[model samples]
Target chain A: MNITVLLKQVPDTTAKITISGGKVDENSVSKWSMSPYDEYALESGLQLKEKTGGNLVAITCGPERTKKMLTDAAAVGADTLVHISNDGVTDSTHVQKLLAAAVRRFDSQIVLCGKQAADTNSGSTGPGVAELIDAACVTLVTEVNYSEGKFSTIRPSNSGTEKVAVDGLSVFAFDKGTHELRRPNVRGIMMAKKKQVESITSGDLGVVLDSSNVTLNSQNPPPEKPAGQKFEGAEHVNEVVSKLRNEANVI
Target chain B: MAYEALDFYDVDSLLTEEERMVRDMVRDWVDEEVIPNIEIACREGVFPDEWRVALGEMGVLGAPLKGYDCPGLSYTAYGVICRELERGDSGLRSFASVQGSLAMYPIWDFGSEEQKNHYLPKMASGEWIGCFGLTEPDYGSNPGDMITKAEDMGDHYLLNGAKMWITNGSIAELAVVWAKLDGVIRGFIVEKNDPGFSAPEMKGKHSLKASVTSELVFQDCKIPKDRMLPGVKGLRGPFSCLNNARYGISWGALGSAQACFDSAKDYAMSRIQFDHPIASYQLVQNKLSWMLREITKGQLLAYHLGQKKDSGDWIPEHISLAKMNNVDIALEIARVARDIHGANGILDEYPIMRHMANLESVKTYEGTHDIHNLIIGRHITGIQAFTREA
Candidate 1:
């Protein structure tokens, strides 16, 4: 059973968001790091690989800058690295197709990815890839147990948690798990420096490139909240009540 | 949130990705592990014993040494580790420096094959802690004139010496004791439990309080003849080890300065005065700008020196210059930071005072700032100043 983990390199969460020429200026980012949720996914994939004995392949679809993320994944004990070059594609659906192709190319029995990427919080990639590859998909998965060719997944549901046992191929989009990602020690980093990342164009995956249907007119920063008005003394209580009932419309 | 190292001049661009990764990993560990416990440990004046194994598992112990289960990292990476560790606290950085450069380095450079094979792996794994014994009670800067001696018996060597201000001495499993053998300095490995050997922990240290400072005492200690480091003799062996440590201190001081800078900058921005944050004041900006400028210069010095060390182009004078300048600047930055925090800086809640106090020791140790100046002065003028007649 080979496992594939989807990795995304996002700007540091603390980076100040700045818009330039109707798009988010990536150059403004002070650092590039792995998406937070994807860390959980990678941890889950690593655990699964350790238990079931399989090739752990970390796959990412991005431009050259994302190679650092793959190197990082390798440093944390990922056996193989795959980079799908989709430099121009920004569509969630198109990126999912490329990721699915790489997963299939690796002959993966299990696939794992973040519930959503930090840059684009559209929780669609895992399910979209699952649909494309015809594998059972479980979103918001926290843990997965594998035993004797069967896989059982635990995930949060509306009322309680659900433990779904699925046979054959499956995709687990991970939320926060019991285990966080492990830091790569010095020896691991030194060893990871030698691991080569297999870079492939969409052409190699036999996936034709197409323009994204979604067009960004402009990017804008979130509006700052107004300062809170404080009411003092017993005399202003009525005024505060009236404002809450009528002007604020909370009542 | 991800750690943003103070790279005002885009220094990260100059570093390799691996170096940056190493810095981030160590920085993260420090933030998670060391930062939380440092204040309490400093207050208690006790070095945390648990960190040895954790640091070993992280491969930070003897990180630059090759093989023997060591990480064999680049000098730049080793410098990065020191920088990050010192950013948490100077004590942590001192522990690593003494372990890697002072203790393990001498063994790797001068020890016999058997000694290397026996000690390096154990030290690398943190299974056995090691300390360097060179600085004597009477001989601070002048180690070559030390009275400590090791006598050669037919079957074993009799060692008698007392080493002062030894880091990791009390808990170390082995001490790399440098003593005069027939008026020539040689390295010998003294086991902690050896007869007539005892390491007594020195108490009442205000500086480097989070580190274990002890005295290594040897009273006619018996050592196996094979325990001696066979490859090297004379003052050159110890000087080489000092150079390695001095190089690391050059980088480690930058970390202490950076932590103070960060704390001061944040505190200044949030601390309100006269209906505005004190950071809006010109005086505050002046201090902040000065600190940033010095720290940036220190970073460049350490970075270039790390490159030179990696390429085998660096000389002892280069190490002295960096060690002297960086520690001096870091001490200055800590003072400025202490002022920026007003009265709050003195409290343990803020790291400014702690760093300020720690930098004092840093400035004094690894060849005091004045000693480094003399070393560099000799390099430039081709004249020895220490022994010159007034």
Candidate 2:
């Protein structure tokens, strides 16, 4: 089986975000890392590939700096790396079409990606690529098992977890699964420095982008939280109760 | 809040992408693994036995050595590993230094191919713990006067000596024992179970509490002829190992200092006094300013030293200077940080006192501050200041 994992590079979760000129100022982001949820997706792919025995490829879309995430993915056991260089932003559908082309080129039997990118939290790429490629799509997957020719998966439903089986090629949008992401050993990091990433433009994948319909008006930082009121001494007990009951709305 | 390393001089720009990756990886690991348990380990006065395997799996045991299942990292990368580990606790960095630069480095540098192939792989994987035995019970600053003797008894060598203040001594599976044979210092690989060999753990320590310090005793210890490290002999063999370890200390001291600075700055910013935060006070700012200034200089010194070492332009004098200067500054920083924490610093809840205590041991070990100064003086004045008339 051929498995492909979709990865995205996002600003490190700890980096302080600042805005300039109606958009997030890229320069203000000091560090970048693999999107958190994508790590779970990659973990699921790696575990499945370990038992099923197949080629594993990690794919990402962005500029040159994003290649670091691909290297990070390779360190943890991605065999082939594909970089779709698209410095310009495209609509979600166009990006999905580009990813679908790469998935088809790799002849992937199963595709795995994060439920949502850490930065945008759009959660659309995995299902969108699946629709474009005409493959079965499963979201919020927590567990997966594979047999001779069938794939068994467990995903959360509106009420509870539901077990589903698929017979054909499929895409899985993973949630936090049973397995935590594995940290790459030093040897893997050293070897990853030598792993080559194949960088190509979206045009190389035979995909064209149309103008996006979405527009951003402005960006602003979240409002500062109000200072917490401190209640001290027994004399203020009734006042605290009144505030909790009336203003805070908690009894 | 996540931990951030001090890089005020844009030192990250000087490093390669791979180097940055190494720093960040080890930094994250230390934050997750070492920081949480360090205080408890210190309070219990024992090194976490489980860390050996974890460290080995991370490939930091013999990180800079090539082949033999080693990670083959650059000198800078190794230095960064030391820095990050020491940021969590100096004892942790001491563990890596002893295992890598002291114990494993000599074997890789001076042992036969068979010895290298046999021990380096196992040591790298943390399957077998190794410790270096050089500083004798009575001879520390002057190891040349060590009384340990290894007499050649035809097919085997009989070794008898005692090494004190040895890190990882009790838990080590193998020890790189240095003893004089025919008045010449030679290195030997002694197994833990060798006849008449013992490593007794030493209890009680106000400093480096999270590490296991012990005394290695060898009484009529018998070892096979082939166990000797044949590639080098004389004081050069052990001095080379010390150089490697001291070089690591230069970088590691900065880590401890940075930890102190980080804590001091954060504490001063939030610790309110009178009406404003303590950070607004001039006295507090003075201490923080001194720490940042000294740390920045020490970082530059360590970075340059690493580059020179990798490029083959460095000498022992450079290492001595760096070790002496960085450790001195680190100890001062710890003191300042402790003062800034006011009584809260003494508690294990804040890392200030632990770091302050650990830095004391660091300043004294790997050739004390005064000894290194003499080494530097000798390099400049063409006279060996460490020697005296007999």
Give the TM-scores of the predictions, in the order they appear: 0.93, 0.95
- Count of clashes, each model: 0, 0
Q: How would you encode candidate 2's per-residue C-alpha lDDT over B86-176 as one tens digit per residue?
A: 9999999999999999889999999999999999999999898889899987899999989999999999999998999999899999999
Best by DockQ: 2
Q: Where is the poorest 10-residue window by lDDT in model 1 chain B?
A: B1-10
lDDT of residue B121 for candidate 1: 94
- Runs in model 2 deviating more than 4 A are A158-160, A232-251
Each model's interface RMSD (Å)? 2.0, 1.7
Chain A fold similarity by TM-score, each prediction: 0.92, 0.93
Candidate 1 off by > 4 Å? A19-23, A157-160, A209-251, B388-390
Clashing pairs in 2: none
